[model samples]
Target: MDEILDVVSLVLILIGALLCLTAAIGLVRFRDVPSRLHAATKPQVLGMILICLAIALSLRSWPVVAFLVPIVLIQLATAPLSAHMVGRQAYRNGTIDRASLHVDELAGSSETPPAAGG
Candidate 1:
């Protein structure tokens, strides 16, 4: 059972690493802030979860997992929210490319730039 769990943990870690690699690739391929944010958030949260799970498994005990639970919980809750907030701010600020987006709720509603009138 312990060996089986170890193999599962290793697989999870590998999958998590693969997700991170995908996110890295996405950082180059994605043309805009929201798209890049989408790529980065999931992999980061999942990677941390897998890493913690791996640590818990390697210990082969429950006590370590208990400690890990809050960490994962905090990340799971906050990571996506933070990513969304950042993406929203970038969109609002017009930092993201318009061409990369298929639909933007705030599109065309961006604040007008102030004139340099004396």
Candidate 2:
């Protein structure tokens, strides 16, 4: 049982490391903001979760799991949100190529506010 647990933990760690590496490569190779954001958030978050799981498994302690759970939850919540904000900002700034977007719902939305006393 202990040997199996160790093997599983090691495998999880290796897979997590590979996912992180892929995210890094995608960040460098992707030209567009949305694509980079996808690369930065999706796999990176999964990789972090896997790594944390591995750490908890190896440590085999309630305190470790208690610490890791919140870390995973926070990453799960924040990664996509931050990515969305960055991508939205990039689009608003006209840094992202419009042609790359298949459907831009935000296109019709106006950013400017109405005049106060008009």
Candidate 3:
């Protein structure tokens, strides 16, 4: 049982580390802000969750879980929100690649209405 737990823990940690590495690579390799945001947030959040799970598994203690549960919850809550804000900002700021978007809902909405006097 102990050995099994250790093996699982190791695998989880390795997978998490690999995910983090992939996120880093994606961050550097992706061209535009939206794509980069996707790369940065998605995998990184999963990676963090996996890493925290691995820590919980290794410790196998109620106290550790008490701490980790909140951490994972906070991370889950924040990552997407932060990503959305950044992506929205990028789109508004004209840093996102419009060509890459299949359908831009914000595009039409963002255009200012012509002044009545003009």
Candidate 4:
């Protein structure tokens, strides 16, 4: 059982490392902000979770699990929110290519509101 746990932990670590590497590659290779944001957030968050799980498993201690839990939760909470904000900013700034999006829900909305005093 101990040996099996060790092997599983090692495999998880290796897979996590590979995912992180792919995220880095995607950031470099992707042409647009939305794509870059996808690459930066999705796999990166999953990779972090996997790595943390492996650490917790390898350590096999309640204290280690306790420490890793919040890290994973915070990452899960923040990554998508940050990615959405970045992508929205990119769209508003015209940095992202409009043609690449299949469905644009924000097309009809104005970028800025009218002045209240007027």
Candidates' lDDT values, in order? 0.82, 0.90, 0.89, 0.90
TM-score for every candidate vs. truth?
0.76, 0.92, 0.89, 0.91
Report the Cα lDDT for residue 86, model 3: 84
* Model 4 CA deviation exceeding 4 Å by range: 113-118
Those runs of model 3 whose alpha carbons end farther than 4 Å from true positions after fitting are 111-118
lDDT of 4: 0.90
Candidate 2 lDDT at 75 equals 93
lDDT (10s digit) by residue, model 2, range 1-118: 9899999999999999999999999999998998899999989999999999999999899999999999999999999999988887788789988887899888986374366232
Runs of candidate 1 with Cα error greater than 4 angstroms are 99-103, 107-118
lDDT for each residue of candidate 1 in 27-106, tens digit (9 for 90 to 100): 88987787788888888778878888888887877878889999999988998899988886797776988677777777
User: Backbone collision count in every prediction?
Assistant: 0, 0, 0, 0
lDDT of 3: 0.89
Question: Candidate 4 lDDT, tens digit per residue, 1-118?
Answer: 9999999999999999999999999999998998899899989989888999999889999999999999999999999999998887788789988887899988986355576232
| C-alpha RMSD values across all candidates | 4.8, 3.1, 4.4, 2.9
* lDDT, residue 105, candidate 4: 86
Worst 10 residues of 1 by lDDT: 109-118
- By TM-score, how accurate is candidate 1? 0.76
Candidate 3: give the clashing pairs.
none
